[model samples]
Target: MRMQVDDLSDERVQALIMNHLESMALHSPPESRHALHFDGLRQPDVTFWSAWEGEELVGCGALKELGAAHGEIKSMKTDPRHVRKGVARQVLAHIIDVAKERGYTRLSLETGSMAAFAPARRLYESFGFTYCEPFAHYKHDPNSMFMTKEL
Candidate 1:
């Protein structure tokens, strides 16, 4: 699969993001869902990437610059039909590489603390992410979990 920077104006990317937000809503309460919308992801601090197998979009992920040496992972999602095929893993690896390229020393992410998110938590763990206290503007949330890794 090839990964490319996404402009967010692409219809396919928009659909994928919509699916991501909808999925998060299904697994977490409104206050616990932290998925960003198009406008949010389009912020100057965020770099979004979409993975494709030829013409098919397989997955997407983003890294948001939190500081000169810190970043946050956002909007990570794999197409429903493509789950378990290493799509998310590939995208995550790419995001980490980008963070390192940008000279970020730490990368963090937030996900739901629910059964539906167990797989995602395991995936992050495999990537060397460990449980951590909330960073950025987040607080202690019973339905949320924060994870981080040193680059």
Candidate 2:
């Protein structure tokens, strides 16, 4: 699959974003769902990417610059139809590489603590992310688990 910086103008990407949002809401309570909608992802600080297999969109993820040395991972979602096909892994790896290239010393992310999120947590663990206290504007949240990795 090929990955490229996404402008979020494609209908496929928009639908995937909607899918991600719907999934998050289905699995987590309102106060706990942190997935961004299109407007939030379109912010200046966030760099979003979409992975494609020729004409098919496989997945997408985003990196948000927090400060000079830290970045946050956001909107990490693989198309349901393409799950277990290494799409998320490639997107996440690309995000990490981009963060390192941007001189970030740390990368962090927040996800749900529910059982539905087990695979996601495992994926982060495999990538060397460890459980951590919430970073950035986040406070302690029973429904949220935070993880971070040093670049």
Top candidate when judged by lDDT against the true structure? 2
Report lDDT (Cα) of residue 33, candidate 1: 84
Per-residue lDDT tens digits of candidate 2, residues 25-51? 899999988888899999999999999
TM-score of each: 0.98, 0.99
Give me the overall lDDT of model 1. Answer: 0.95
Residue-by-residue lDDT tens digits, candidate 1, 57-129: 9999999999999999999999999999999999999999999999999999999999999999999999999
- For residue 19, model 2's alpha carbon misses the true position, in angstroms, by 0.1
Clash totals in order: 0, 0
Misplaced by over 4 Å in model 2 are none
Taking every candidate in turn, the Cα RMSD to the unseen true structure, in Å, is 0.6, 0.5
Model 1 pairs whose backbones collide:
none
TM-score of 1: 0.98
